[model samples]
Target: MAEKYCVENLAVSVLDNLRYQHDWTELQILTHSPVDDLPLPRPLISGLPPRRLYLHPDDQIEMLKSHPNPEGSIPETPVTEWVLPVHLAEKWTLKAFASVFDSMPPENSASPHRVKRVLLATVHDDSTVVYYFMHDGIVKPRQN
Candidate 1:
């Protein structure tokens, strides 16, 4: 039997996996009308993770110096992260990744020109998925 081939299907699969495994919330799929002339390879989705994924080292140093309450630290606000869903059978290259960033629909952008960083989530045969964080451009290196 052949595997199912639907953009929405693949996106949804990853979304469900994210919610279940990672405790991601407020997931939404960004759908765009096909331009015919200009087309993206896959649909992009965004969601909020339970904790911060990217934190600046300088901020952390400041926080440590200030000495925050550790027992019940309340997060100021949660930010949504982007997701690029791909099937387990699919293969991606730099060109493929560039294409996603190059022509991402405005719906994915937080502002007019701001392109959000994405999490590349790949769904497997057993409905398990692996994720990798994908940043838009060069950024300051974070501590390990």
Candidate 2:
């Protein structure tokens, strides 16, 4: 029998891959979203990475400036991952990604300070979910 295709299943698969392979924590499945104020083909995923993923340069500078001591300052909490979950059978476009991004909160809605970037978690038939970070706008090239 052929497998059923649904966002519920897709999200579970992606979450499994994240927990088993990347060791992400505090995962959540987000629903109740509207693409351009309407429904979508699927839902999205959110979670934490094993370590910090991206830190805004402005936020980093603010942290550095606000630290009481020059040495041994406390580190900021890692931001959550806003994931656009997809299945192997699905293909996406820039427009598709944009819709998802537009629908998402700047941070986790439950915790406004949590997430700052979006991630695409593409789940394959083989149960591997490849992740790539997405930015709302063009960013400066990284030093390395």
Candidate 3:
């Protein structure tokens, strides 16, 4: 019988390649699966500093609203990795986005990964498109 393809295997394979290419001092593979059982074919991985992956918009809004002082405040955002399927090739839809969003926890919530932010880097043939997933709320979109 042919071996069944596992998302975790793909993520691990990619991480191995990344480690070799960057020679990162500390590389940790965060989550092997999504928090919720979404139909999308992909796994999520997150980790600590030296780089940031994603930031949810709603998270930013809540940060702004709750801060006691505007000028002097810094919100701690957690960073996570979103390991999308290698075979996937298409545009994203609302249902897909909704599902991804629903699985992530709010910034205030304590996660085993302890990531307040998430970074989703889509690896294509010779390039990558990274999307940030913030906690939950509204905020000023960063000027591109």
Evaluate candidate 1 by giving its C-alpha RMSD to the native, one decimal.
4.9
- Model 1 stretches with alpha carbons more than 4 Å out: 1-4, 33-40, 56-76, 105-113
Error of 3 at 59 (Å): 8.9
Candidate 2 runs further than 4 Å off: 1-4, 34-41, 60-76, 108-116
RMSD of each: 4.9, 4.7, 6.7
- Kindly give the stretch of ten consecutive residues in candidate 2 with the minimal lDDT sum: 32-41
Top-scoring candidate (lDDT)? 1
- In terms of lDDT, model 2 sits at 0.70
State the lDDT of candidate 2 residue by residue for 117-140, as single tens digits.
678777777777787877766766
TM-score of model 1 vs. true structure: 0.68
Count clashes in each candidate, considering only residues at least 3 apart in sequence or on different chains.
0, 0, 19
Instruction: Tell me the TM-score of model 2.
Output: 0.69
Better of 1 and 3 by lDDT: 1
Candidate 3 runs further than 4 Å off: 1-10, 13-41, 51-88, 108-117, 127-138, 142-144
Clashing pairs in 1: none
Worst 10 residues of 3 by lDDT: 78-87
Predictions ranked by lDDT, top down?
A: 1, 2, 3
